[model samples]
Target: MIVETPQLILRPVGTNDVSALVELDSDPAVMRYVSGGAPTPRAVIEDWVVPRAVAELSSRRGGGMWVALDRSNGAFVGWFSLRAPRHGTQPELELTYRLRRAAWGRGLATEGSQTLMRVAFDAPDTGRVFASTMAVNSASRRVMEKSGMRLTALHLGDNAETDGYERGEVEYELRRSDWESARFVWAVRGSTSELTA
Candidate 1:
């Protein structure tokens, strides 16, 4: 296991996960926020996505990609990712997650994200962790906020495939310094809720 939360186990995405990944990408509701509501092709999962995930894990350029599993029953729940900055290796990284429809509305996103945030900030070289989503993807936006990220920017782009192209995409960020300060307070308060309060 790469990282384990109370209810979830994060493991590296491996070549054997192609079928599970295909099952995930084949759900319309799960793919709604991605791929313009179309299920990703199985060939795409086998030939492209799986290879990339495997390579990312092997490179360890950053946290790489992970598969989320239920701790109790050992079922596949979803996947989460922490990747290096788009341009190059840097102290900043990107956070992302996707879940099986069955896992929706269960607070698993926030839980897994909180775990990732802790890992990200714990690294001495990490300066910030960031995430982005379509402006209309309120569910994902809420996850970012609950994970302690603040809205940082909105980028207008050619996201014609998404519903809210006019409003563009939204970026959320949490600096290591801000997380450290809040963590200290949480330690003192002896409650996780105090971090948000």
Candidate 2:
């Protein structure tokens, strides 16, 4: 495990995980909200997920987004990441997550997101983290807010695949200043893990 939380262990993505990631990404139920209901092709997963992830890890000095495993049973749950925004502005990273539909409503998204936020801010180049999702993606929106990101903007996004979803995307942001406030709140509650950056 690269990092351990109260209930999760974040492990580096290895070559052995490609099949599982392909399976996860291919779950129609899991991919519904992401790709307007179509499953991601295995070739796309290889062409996209692997090299991009290796690149992120290499550049971040080993602080790449991670594959989350269950601490209790060692189950593959999902992946969470805090990526330096490719768009150059405001020192912001992007927070992202994808979990099995079965994992929904279990607070796993919130847990993993908060952990990734810490990991992100712990790094040298990251100053803020943002999350974006379809405005209709309320569950994802809630997790973003729950992880300390605040609603910043909502704009029209032309997504050719999602039929009528073209109205736009909503974005939320969490700066290092507010992250400190969040950690303070968690500390008061007796959290065992330390918040970094």
Candidate 3:
């Protein structure tokens, strides 16, 4: 599937994205929160990550990972995902993203996240959309909030070796009912503006 936003073009990840993915993950700053600044081995990305994403794309599942590109220049910015949680049931998908350090502070994460949430809520079967991040990662938490998800849970880290494990993890979620209500309000506000004009 292809999804476009004002500043990004998102497409299903493929073998061609291997190098870019590796480069993105190789940056210590980019992977700081994920792997304690360790670069993901290229073999792991090539032999596992890309193939799994390709398989998930073809699985006819409601969600999969998408590589994000800068619309004007086609630069690889990062990737975003909306997929079933490893231990969670249907109607509740997980939202997650990782952008190049260069892409930070530009609001691209929040923009892509908000768009993906809309896509999730468009499907009648999707009852909730959720995301999780290290509690100390205030930037990611802001993206979740800007995308309209509310804090729902805090999970203690299971591994002491992981960075920021002591602070734990935070999960945020947006329910279908809440999304619909927000859409209605936006529609009404737009209509009122048009009438006034």
Candidate 4:
């Protein structure tokens, strides 16, 4: 259990996860917003997705995609992550999350995202963690906002060329300084005591 949220677990997605991944990734509703129309094929899951995810876990950097599981029944809810792109030219981390449609509206996404930021800032040396989404992905944007990340920029996605990127994409970022401030704010709220004097 790398990260334990109120209703989810962020852990390594290992070989044992193949079945669950297959089932979750096959769900039409779950992949709707992602692929825009199609389910993730098993071939993609077997030969690419899972293997690539595991490879990320092997990196020296703490950033990598993680499996998110339901705390109640231990079922696979989906996945969330803050990963540095493979190109390595940019140091920026990409924040991401995807959960089963049934898991929507439960606040699990926000809880899991906040935990990722905590882990990132807690690391020995930290930079920034940002997540981007289709401007239309209000749900994801809400999670990013709730995690204390703010909208930093808007751009036409490279691949948005196909996914209607021409419309635009939004990036939300949380810097170490900002996270530190939020921590202080939370600490203050948690510490404030009612005055009786």
Best by TM-score: 3
Model 2 RMSD, rounded to 1 decimal: 2.4
Cα deviation of 197, candidate 3, in Å: 22
Quick one: ranking by lDDT, best first?
A: 3, 1, 2, 4
Which stretches in model 1 have alpha-carbon errors above 4 Å? 59-61, 192-197
Clashing pairs in 1: none
Candidate 3, 104: how far from true, in Å?
0.6
Q: Between prediction 3 and prediction 4, which has the larger TM-score? A: 3
Looking at candidate 3, what is the lDDT of residue 78? 100
By TM-score, is 1 or 3 better? 3
Clashing pairs in 4: 160-165
Go through the candidates in order and give each one's C-alpha lDDT: 0.82, 0.78, 0.85, 0.75
Better of 1 and 2 by lDDT: 1
Model 3 scores a TM of 0.91
Q: What is the lDDT of residue 6 in candidate 2?
A: 69
Taking all chains together, each candidate's TM-score versus the true structure is 0.89, 0.88, 0.91, 0.86
Clashes of each: 0, 1, 0, 1
lDDT of 4 at 120: 66
lDDT of 2 by residue, 16-117 (tens): 778878878888777766888787788776787776776778885324668888888999988887666566656667888899776788888888887788
**Native-vs-model 4 lDDT?**
0.75
